[model samples]
Target: MEEWTVKVNHCAVKKEKPQTDQLEFGRIFTDHMFVMDYSEPLGWHDARIVPYQPLTIDPSAMIFHYGQSVFEGLKAYQTPEGTIQLFRPEKNLQRLNRSNDRLCIPAIDEAFILEALKQLIYLDKEWIPSAEGTSLYIRPFIISTEPYIGVAPSHQYKFVIILSPVGAYYKEGINPVKIAVENHYVRAVKGGTGEAKTGGNYASSLKAQETCSQKGFAQVLWLDGVEKKYIEEVGSMNVFFKINGKVYTPMLNGSILEGVTRNSVIQLLKHWNIPVIEEKLSMEKLYQAYLDGELEEAFGTGTAAVISPIGQLSWEDKDLMINNGTTGELAKSLYTTLTNIQYGKEADPFHWVEKVSEAYAVK
Candidate 1:
């Protein structure tokens, strides 16, 4: 693929800044954006950076009607050396194409997209937050833009990448969050679009998320769509389990999001000789492990919250508490290892972090 034509158009004003001390996730955005269009005749053209503004789409856009859209979430960290770098962005690009393949959306060449993103982020380097517990959040998405309602794949599509300067996910600092084990509603089904990071999957979970919020939980612990006995994942994140002296996560069974963080933790655990297994983990066995003192801890891993320890898992009138109602030792180990590599504090044995150099936004 040839280099994507890059143009810098800056936003006029910053959206009301969130208190850097109270940075909430996904709330504050930068001043510039990168967008490209694709049509059956002209694939991926008009790649440009424009002012961060509300998008205008036709009422009959495919995204609004037949639900053809996919997205990715990752972050740009301000390294200790003061350079902005992305954490394993190639993995994200790979997953984006997986989603594209699932949704019948044409693939944007990964290297081409990465260069465009680097060029765009270089232009918005100033937007990369430097304060402790703050960094630039990157959201890249694609929508079927053909103005029609027939429900077939759209002839036109739009791909956009936007950056948001965000503070830490928790204003109170990195603390353990309570999660509820959902028994009734399933997040994704077997042989479905469960693994794809499409907007519809997220939209289907809003009600469940609301229920979790109402019940005073941070997120919902989803199980297999059919069996409903085994573990799956959390909202847009993958789940990890620490049982007895071993670490376990549900194997990638074509129904769960394969998180980059999850893979990183598994690699680091192996590096330390910590026995880690990826297999089907049943909720029945999970609760039994807790009762037998075999289940020591649990947590969810993703780009948004990093490795968030699950302090409590409540379900079916059964409440299982994880180690003193606070952060687990395993959680701390994984978090430190992952973030250390991310911020360049430790050697990246997996070569995951990708550094961004030179700016592209037309300043």
Candidate 2:
């Protein structure tokens, strides 16, 4: 992989480090970021790492009007052995390209951008939180920069990467969360940008999420837009259910985000010789399982939360509780296993953790 040029921040102003316990997700940013530009014929150029600052773009940039943007989230962990590592970063890059294709953004050179990311991470490696359950959140995004907004794809764009030291997704730790099944509003339909990590899909979900929040729910479990019968996913994570000693999740039906943690959960389950299935799971079937006392547990998987146990699921005015509204055995095991590998507490048999060596840490 080709290297990205580094421009040291001569006027670097380091902020006072917040107490680890006071750390919030996406609240505090590091001192530097990686940036690259794109334009017709020129392609991606002028890649460099610069001090974190406000961006200056045309007010009429297409991103402000047409919503031509995409983003990806991943984390860098400070291992117990004092090494910094990332989990399945290539998968995030691959998904970023998929999102770029869907949003008419030019595809980036995966290897090159990944190398650039590592360089950026190494430069800001100290920003990675060392507290338990804390890590550096990485946000890589692209936005349309073309000034003209005549309802066409932008010819110019900007790709940027920023880092934030995050504590944890849930303050309650890996406890169970309450979810409200959305029936009135749909997040995305088939043949839409559901699979892509674009801002529009998330923006369209805020109303539903707001409604669910007012009802004392943490997130909304989205059903398919067409029939509204089959389960799709949570607002920000892929969902899984354990019924009668078997695990099942909604299949990728062109309307679901393929989460890296979701895939890891499936692989870990299969590795343990547990039966797992990916298919269209209906809310009716889920409710029936609950009534029959077969629904053992449920959880949501994502890069942010990693493993969030779902204890209460409200659908059609019925509050169905799983595992007595507590984190189940399987959910706890999966969380422990996944975090162990991420924090270097155990051997990474899956080879998911990639190290950012100290050599690259020096500018």
Candidate 3:
């Protein structure tokens, strides 16, 4: 495995950290961030952990012109005994490489980045919130930073990982959400960048999101681009549905993101001896299921929310309420189970949580 780091010139560990209960999601950042440079010829270099701050970039950087950027989001939680643990770090690493390949970004050695990430979290250990809903959110990204604005991949790039202290993603305490089923604007197509965590895929969804908001929906549930019938994914997370004691989700058809939370939920359900099916779930089938009263629940999953239940779905002058506009039994159980493992409240038999050694705990 490759390794790289330049010792921090100035450490920004919080002097008097605020209470975790008062935190807002992704607002309070830890003292330091990890950054590095990558070029075609030089590979990766100048890797370092620096005080958190805004980056200085040329106005005409390639990323600015061509949207050549990709990013991943995950979190580290402070257990009851004060250990910082990350859930399925390897999954994020693998997904990052998949995004790198799709975006033509230089990929870093996973071990190297993971090591650097843990070290940074160790240095800012005090900033990690220990409250029930608080966690240290990590955002790792790669961007084209070269001055030239040509369409081709830039020679210079930046790989950075920043930490933020976040409260639970469901600020309103997981009161159901309304999603506007998107039939006009598609989030990703088969040959598109949706499967990859590239910025362009998200950038393309902004307008649709705006339209959804204007239509009084919390999010836009996207469908396949070509057929416009099969459900693809929700705006930022993959979605799941429960019907008649079975769990079903859209298969990875190169038009949807394979989210970490989605995968975890699948494992957890299977562990509970529940049947899970990954197939093309279409809007018509979902509508029919809801009409038949077979659809028990629907929810979206991501690192941010873990699980957010969908209370209502609106499409073309019609409204469908899931489980009477309340968080269903399945949604509630899934959320509780996942968070239990995250905060060490439940037995993590799957060994999903990776603990940071006590020796490296910042004193």
* TM-score, per-candidate, Cα-based: 0.95, 0.97, 0.95
- The best candidate by lDDT is 2
> Over the full model, what C-alpha lDDT does candidate 3 score relative to the true structure?
0.86
Per-model CA lDDT versus the true structure = 0.85, 0.91, 0.86
Clashing residue pairs, backbone N/CA/C < 3 A, model 2 = none
Displacement of residue 122 (Cα, Å) in model 1 is 1.1
Q: For candidate 1, write residues 222-264 as lDDT tens digits.
A: 9899988999997668988888889999999888998888888
Candidate 1 wrong stretches, greater than 4 Å: 10-19, 359-363
Question: Which window of ten consecutive residues has the lowest lDDT sum in model 3?
Answer: 1-10
lDDT, residue 112, model 2:
85
Candidate 2 ranges with C-alpha deviation above 4 Å: 1-11, 170-172
For model 2, residues 279-331, the per-residue Cα lDDT tens digits are 99999999999999999999999998889999899998799999999999999
TM match of model 1 to true structure:
0.95
Q: What lDDT does candidate 1 reach at residue 23?
A: 65
